[model samples]
Target: MNSKLIKELPDLVRNNVISQEVATTIEAYYQSQQANSPNRLFTVFGVLGSLLVGLGIILILAHNWDNFSRTVKTGFAFLPLIIGQLVVAFSILKHKSKTWKEASGTFLFFTIGSSIALVSQIYNIPGDLSAYVLTWVLLSAPLIYLLKSNVLAILHLIFITFYAYEIGYGHYYSNETPWLYLVLLGIAIPHYIQLLKHRTNDNITSLFNWLYPLSVTIVLGTFVKDLSELGFLMYVLLFSVFYNLGKMPFFDTQKLRKNGYLIFGSLGIVVLMLIMSFDSFWYIEELVFFAQESYISILLFFVNGVILGLAYYKKWLQSFNVFQYVFILLSLLYLGGLNLPVLGTVIINILILALGITTIKIGADKVHFGILNYGLFIITALVVCRFFDTNMSFVIRGLLFVGVGLSFFLTNYIMLKKQSSKAKTL
Candidate 1:
């Protein structure tokens, strides 16, 4: 029970709602439950302490490092790694301690990177940032498995994505083959899977939730160079994959941020559709042709279709989500290309308005303020966007804005009144 309910127990006992013995038993049970809960603060501090100590050691060693000879410098570079390895090994073998495991794992992870940097700096290695990051990620990838460390896994995932982005877009401006990052990414997936399997609701699991989607988002843009116009299709299909994953049992239980795939996927599709609704996207001058890489987009579409089909078959997709169906209409609009730009824009605008109304109705029925406000925000944004377009008359735009504002106030007022009435009845 919560604090309010617990506090009310004494009053109930005093009124003879239950005996003193029963009240005592209930209090004792809850106290035991509280005692058994994990200490998250301790874990946070332990991880922070480990990072600070590791950085401190590196800073301390860097003081007057020019005085050391070649052999001495090499030995110094490896010293932290050796120490970190020993600490991690001891944590694994000698104790059943999460703090020790996390601390040592974090230290070792950084130490490995530091060792590589020191060696590179000592020898004047010739490579770009991408190469450096790839090496660091490769070195640290093993720590995830060795220490069963989610922190290291998450860090490695981030680094590998950085490597991919830097190699693909940052270095040389037009690097064609950045596929090695996918191999590196594949190595990190097993650790994430293991974390999910073992401690599905742990803080680390939550971190993985954010990290995986972020990694995908980071690497997603790199495909545009080769795929060209088909990149948009790839993105739509990728978002569909994320949406399907969000409907999975694991992600379904998570909060909005933790369910990054679903949130990003849904919002991504909506935003893309909205952007595509404009005249610029449908203009004849902006026409796009099929590229060889467009086949990849087709493959992704098929994959997305299979996943959505399975979801429908399994009844996982209950009601129509505005995001889910917008893509089909978007694909149709894309097929229309420059021929029916005006019609396409009209259809998309109507679709957005219809979607906003549908979302508001669903939210009101469910009594969900967040969903209701989300719908209102969409309508407000659509109206605001039209303000920039000179094609629409000022008087019509003003009316649109006024209508949206009134709807917001009226919908919220009615919902509030209903909620108040229900509370009074209760």
Candidate 2:
């Protein structure tokens, strides 16, 4: 219930459906109900104040650190940490409000990181930013659970992702493998699961949507060298996993940007299919097989196998996902030894067309203009691509472009008409 809803109540009263006295009572009731919810503005300002104070202290220390002796620098390094710790303790023991916990936890999270950095600088510790991030994230992870803070949870995800990029993906030199990143990623899962269980629509839920797909994207290349050309197959399956995961009840309802898996998966599938549509990719010299087995290749093969196994187990065919079935068909095409390359090209083209049509049908069912346009864009892109890829007559290409233009116009017109009809009914 909201005051926003009560604005419409005046219309009912004017039409003699209700009296002003009834409307006022209803508005008062809704206001009272809303007052019981947590104050978002208070929480936001609390968190912001904590961040500003923490950063301000860091800036102050950094500005004067060069003039300070070792003894003083060491004291300053621990000072913020001790203060942050005291604030957190006070929140736990006395305040215990959500606002206090969030503010204290965020302050301490930054303080601990700053302390670690300053102490390392003071001691001239030998480590890169990757190791520093790893240490900071490990120390800060407990804040997410102890304070039950979504902000800390998101911070953990962001830092760990940077750590993965730095160490796991060879952005920085580290003895650790990418597998360590995966293990570290697990630390945030419990907190994420808690959010999902209790606060499904909470803003923090959107961070998980972006973080997981981003993690996969960062790590996907770690095993690419091993799979070689067959890596494309693994990517296809991985994207399929993302797409299917997006289809789950929670993510399906989210906005497109918030539903990272769906957006990335759909675009990845389309792009990969387009690449495969070219005869050149199929006949590439690097398209070697398991002639030389590597751990990365073995891991990728296992992952793809698991995805296919799960899809078949759950019978995902009923969902009408073109890529899911086409993946299998494409693999078969590759294995059947019709190695002329054009065979793969032909299958891919057909698959893309079918996928485009299916996407349009799905958009029609959902009555979502963005999705409808997305499907239409896919088809239009295909035709445009083929205009260059194929040697069709100029007149035929012109006709195809004109036809696609008309299709776009007609679909949009129809959508507008349907929307108007619905508005009239309402």
Candidate 3:
């Protein structure tokens, strides 16, 4: 059957027009199952069940390790861990080992590592969170390399993430935490090297898949914390990531499927916008731009100009989105530099109207995707500004609101017409 028929066949079966066996057969024939790896549902359940039992043992030991002697407990303390390490070594040695052996060995090392540390805490080991995370991460790294197991790599990466997220975000600054950054980079290097050489292991790729952006964002966020002025700079940095990724020659579908550079970058942009909604990242406040702190204001303006210039250079200049920040900078200059402090409210309304009208014109005449966003920008800006600017004249403001309301339907119609015309040209 054709694609349409195949799609409809599922619904037909679901509606009880076909038998379940027949449906299953059709699905299997249409979707070929890869034969390299056999199904391992039982193996997975066994591992999970064993892990739970192991965890129960650790909790019991953690609570009652005090009654045992130093030598007896020391041997006992390392017994599970030593055994786990040996199992990992054995699994690695057997190149043709089954997946269960490989997975179980990695799982045992992980369990033993954590359990040993918890037991160590019973002996009153006095290490900080960073030190603790570092120790565990180092111990686990070899399992990743020796076994070439993503589970081991992923486990190490998870603990490394915890180290960075918990301690890095909450404390410390400067080059002192270079060790922590190094550990994170260490976790990434093996996978990055592999992903470049071979994009076959989707699971390993998926781990870095998440870990890279997460690690990058965490690092960057740590760098720019507590700096409102630098928040705009952070957006520029984030967008630069998107601009690069969207241009990269690599066609690995896994990269797009698992990673979210755009989502993270967009979040950074939104935060910058919200901060600018009050203090204005690119310029001084609305009414007071003329008498700005000249040095700081100029530096910030130049920074914003650089961001827009990069965006334009990359040809990623989505109209209203790029201009949202640009307008914040401009609106500051337009209202404050013009010596019209009392007319601030009027200027904001006028600004919204201008954006809406420009959108309609752009779609109608210019044939641009960026233009599609302009009316939404104006409408949202009007709504937001009105909510905060409580001192404005009611009558004049009421008229502006009504005027923008009418513009909405008109702009939609114009953009639709423009889009239809553009489609014809295509």
Compare the candidates by lDDT and give the number of the best one: 2
Candidate 3 residues lying further than 4 Å off, grouped into runs, are 1-33, 38-51, 95-102, 115-119, 122-124, 171-179, 200-207, 224-228, 246-259, 280-386, 389-426
Order of candidates by lDDT, top first? 2, 1, 3
- Clashing pairs in model 2? none
Cα displacement (angstroms), candidate 1, residue 105, comes to 0.6
lDDT of 3 by residue, 50-72 (tens): 57766776778768777877777
| Window of ten residues with lowest summed lDDT in model 2 | 291-300
Q: 322, model 2: CA deviation in Å?
A: 1.5
For candidate 3, the TM-score is: 0.60
Q: Best candidate per TM-score, number?
A: 1
Task: Give one digit per residue, the lDDT tens place, for model 2 in 1-426.
Answer: 665678899998999999999999999888887776667789889999999998888888889889999999999999999999999999888957788888899999998999998888889999988788988988888888888887788788778777777765665334455566777789888888877788776666776777778777766655455444666666766676677677655677777768887887788889888887887767744455553323444464455567656757876545666755555665666556245687778877888998898888778777788888888998998898898888899999999999999999999889888888888999
Any residue pairs clashing in model 1, and if so which? none
Ranking by TM-score, best first? Answer: 1, 2, 3
Compared with the true structure, model 2 gives a TM-score of 0.85
TM-score of each: 0.88, 0.85, 0.60
Model 2 misplaced regions, further than 4 Å: 12-33, 171-176, 226-228, 253-258, 285-319, 330-339, 421-426
lDDT (10s digit) by residue, model 1, range 1-426: 358878988899999999889988988898897776545678678888989998898888889688999889999999999998999889988964666777788888888889988998889887777778878888878788887766677778878887778767785568455678779989988887887788777677877777787788778777676445567766777776787677666787666557777777767766776786676666544435565346666776677778778778888876777665655656656656656678877887888777778778767977778778888987787777667865788789888888888998999999999888889999
